[model samples]
Structures are given as C-alpha cells and as structure tokens.
Target chain A: MLGAMEVVSPTAPPRGARGLHRFANPGRFLRLAGRALPWVSAIGLVLVALGLVWGLFFAPADWQQGDAVRIMYVHVPAAWLASAGYMALACASAVALVWRHPLADLAAVEIAPVGAGFTAICLVTGSLWGKPMWGAFWVWDARLTSVLVLFFLYLGHIALTRAFDSPERGYRAGAILALVGVVNLPIIKFSVDWWNTLHQPASITLTGAPTMYVGMLWPLLFTALGASFIFAALVLARLSAAVMERRIRALLAARAEGT
Target chain B: MTHLAYIVPAYVSALVIPAWLAGEAWLRLRRARARLLALEGGRRR
Candidate 1:
C-alpha cells in the first residue's frame, strides 16, 4: 500500500522514485522538513507574539466581561487547536491504516501529546477566566467537562500506541482508537447548545459573521492561525525524529545479525 | 492587573506549556539526528 518507498537504506543508491512515492522516502522528508523548519518556526512565533500583544493591550475589552475577556486570547485558540488537532490526528490515523503510510503513522504518534498540551491550556485558561466571571475555578459545565474528556482521549491514544511489543501492532491499535475517538469531536462542539449549559454558544460560525467585536476578533484569529502553524512545525520535528529512531533500531539490529 | 492571581497563572500556562512541548520535541529531534549521523558515519568508515 505504501508503494516502493521503503526507508531508503542509508547504504543504498538514491532511486528515481516518482509521484507521491518520491516524497514518502524518509530521506526526502527529512530534507524538506529541515528546509521548512526555520521558516515555519520564525513566522509562527512572530505572529503569535504580535497577536497576543494586540489582544492583551490594544483589543477593546468587553463591556460585559471587562478585562477577564482578555483570557479568551489564549483560551479560545487553545480550544480551537485542541479540537482541530484531534481531527488532524484522526485523519493521520486514517491515512496510516488505509495506505500504511509510514509518515502518517509517525504523525499520528506525535500529534497526541501536543494536542493534549493544547487541551490542558484550554482547561486551565478557561478556569482562570471562570474564577473572575463565574465565581468558581471550575464547574461541571458541558463545554468544560467535554473538553476534559477530550484530554483523556489524547492520553488514551498515547498509552495504547505504546502498549504493544511490536511497533506495527501498536500503531494499528492506536490508529483504531483515534478513529473511534473522533466521534467525541462533534459532541464537544454541540454540547453547549444541546444542554442548558453556562457556557455560551459559539460566537463565530462559518456561515455567519462573528458575534465578537471586530477589534477583539482580529487578534483571536491571528493567534489561532499562528498557533496552528507552530503545531505543524512541532509535529514535523517529531516525525523526523521518529523516522531516525526507526532507522537507528534497524541499524542496530543489522549489526547484531552480522556479528 | 485585575484578578492578578487568575490572569497571571492563565498567561503563564499559555506561555509555559507550549514552550515545554517545543523544547522537548526539539531536544528529541536533535539527539536522534546526532545519533543517526554518528552511526552512519561509523558504517561508511
């Protein structure tokens, strides 16, 4: 399913591999990722800083929420990335299971913990915002509780993917778990509207204009995009490392066999 | 500085978790690259 693109043995001559298969070669991926890393990291970090500065200082405070709404700058983006990152993880899992793409398997492995980190940020920041506005550090609200479930789902995937003796079996199991856990995403999105929850309905929708003021909305958008890029860069870095790790194992095994 | 306790912790986490994650990932990638390069260099020699 992965075509002729193996690990492209370090000792072997470069093949004239073509099409999607060409990029599948781990060596080519490493080269491309190395070239892209600095640019992605610089742009992402810069945008994130600029957007956060605008939100913290220049964006108009909500009359209702006052300065507490400033917490949304980080919280909302973390929430977005947490959910969106899971979607990417599931998609990567699907690609790995169906096509046996080695890179997709590696990507699925890497996306879990970073996605969990974003989820933790979302929860912590939301709690911070809650203390001032809702008078409690936390509540059993639908949105809040559902996101906590999402965080556990990430942890579950991480544990399952490493639970087996065989790497292939572990990856297969993790991919299946990720695909199943994707059912939670839609539930998390609609939980607020489905239940009489304290959490408000989404302020922004694809079909309608954002309910948030323009001054505040722009920074939120900027930071979300910036954070998403950094997410990509992080995953790419991990994937390269994973590929090298697999190769190192192979090399060690081969030396053992030769002796 | 209103609600200094809440807001400070919130931003601190927003900054800290990602930094920790990025640092860990970069260190892993660097270490793996170094090891792989060393092994490849040994094999070629």
Candidate 2:
C-alpha cells in the first residue's frame, strides 16, 4: 500500500541521490506538497480544535494554578515546537554545509522565521502564564534566560541569512550561526533542574511515568501533535514558495544572459 | 473564569501566530507560482 502511494504521489522523492535526490528535486517536491497540503491542513485544524476544546473546557484545572493552568494547552506545545524547530534548522544547515544540497539550504533559510515565530509565541505565552503563577510577568531565571537567548539566536539566524546579496553567502553564514546556537537547546532543557529558578522542573520525564494525570496529559499530547502537524504544513508551504522563487530567479538569469 | 485573561491570550497567541505564518506562507507560494508561470509562458512566446 505504501509503495503504491509512493508510485502515485508526486511528492515522493525518486530513488536517487540515496533517496535525498527525490525530495531534492523542487518540481517533485512542489507536486507532492500540493497533494499533501490540504490533508495536513485539515487534520491539523481538526486536532488543534479538539485539543483546545478538551483542554480548555473538559480537562481538570490544576489545584494550584487554577484556570490559569489552561495556558499549558498552548504554551507547552509552542515551547516544544520552538526547540524542535531549531534542531531541525540545525540539521538542515548541516546538510547544506556538508552536502551542498540546495534544497537543504533553502529549508534552513525558510525555517528560521517560522521557528522564530514559534519561539515568540512560547515566550509571550510563558509570560502570561508566569504572571499569574509566578507573581511576575517576566524573570531572568535560567530557563527563561536561555529561552530568551534562543529567541535571539533565531533572530540572528534570520538576519544573517538575509544579510548578503549572494544567497550562498547568506546560507553559509546562517548555517554557522545555527550550528553554534544548538548549545542553547540543552541549556533550555536542563535549566529548571540546574538552577533554583521560579520555573518548574520537567513534568514529563523520559524514564519515569508522566507526573500529569491522563485527563490533562491526553489533551496536552493532542495539542502537541496538532501543533507539530501545523508546523510541518507551514514549513512545506514555505519551502514550496522558496523553491518556486529560486526557479523564477534561475529562469530570469537565463533570459538575461540570452538577451 | 478566574485568570480568564491569561488563558485567552495564551490560546489566542498560539492560534493567531501560526495562522498568520500559514497565511504568509500561502501568499508567498501563490505569488511565486504565478511569477514562475508567467516567466515560463513568456519564454515559450
């Protein structure tokens, strides 16, 4: 069944360049993206709606945080995606730098702004939640500070990628910045434990069972999944735009040369 | 209803930002597609 889908899907990368070439082809990518976009968009919207309704209306509120706890439905997922998006950006940057993959470079460049936006959402929502729970709107604690730095790193990556007239130069500069900025991810993850800050420690741990009850946990997971799918859909849409723009530029260059 | 202010903004920000990003991405895709089509059409002419 999967093979059959692959055969029919325009988005399926051809079995070349060790499979990377299949997706590396912008034309194939655009076609695949076109087919997948609506499904992703629809599923993402439905899941997010269900998650929000379950979280905001049905889930039990925290004994301590009260209704303010509802913020977690949105905040946690945005924070999760913010960090995950950066990791993806770093990986794409590595591929662009090492493999000289044009599509990888474009993906790296396109992902920055989206990641930055997620980081901003995470920060703002964190502040909103913090004000009621922590008794303050903003804090320079380790976790908060590291996430702030992550946001800055994102801004820096965006600026660097657009700085040079030559796209390749911009990609190289941004790739290096992305590679270096990865150090912040671990710090953000461990900051709550490493230092005694106002921010709470991880509720969801890898080894032990989740501290949260199933009612709250299920909604949180749903929201996280919904947000992730939405992020993927956005990335695909942006990547298609970038690929199309690149093609336009190439065609224009060829026309100019001919004239 | 307590802390409704906080809850509302958080969800709003979460939804609005991604929605805006999606809209921007879609617009860019449409513009780029149109430009590519026009450029190719002109070349054929």
Query: What TM-score, computed on C-alpha atoms, does each candidate reach?
Result: 0.93, 0.93
Itemize residue pairs with steric clashes in candidate 2: A11-A32, A13-A22, A14-A22
Error of 2 at A231 (Å): 0.6
In angstroms, the error of model 1 at A153 is 0.5
TM-score of chain B of each: 0.84, 0.85
Docking category for candidate 1? medium
lDDT of 1 by residue, B1-45 (tens): 356677778989999998888888788777787788788778889
Docking class of 2: medium
> Which residue pairs does candidate 1 place in steric collision?
none
lDDT of 2: 0.86
Tell how far residue B39 is off in model 2, in angstroms: 1.6
lDDT of 2 by residue, A1-259 (tens): 0000111212345554565655776777777887787788778788889999999999998888888988998999889999999999999999999988869999998888899999999999999999989899998999999999999999999999999999899999999999999999999999998889889999998989999988999999988998888888888888878888888888889989999
Query: What is every candidate's C-alpha DockQ against the true complex, given to 2 decimals?
Result: 0.58, 0.62
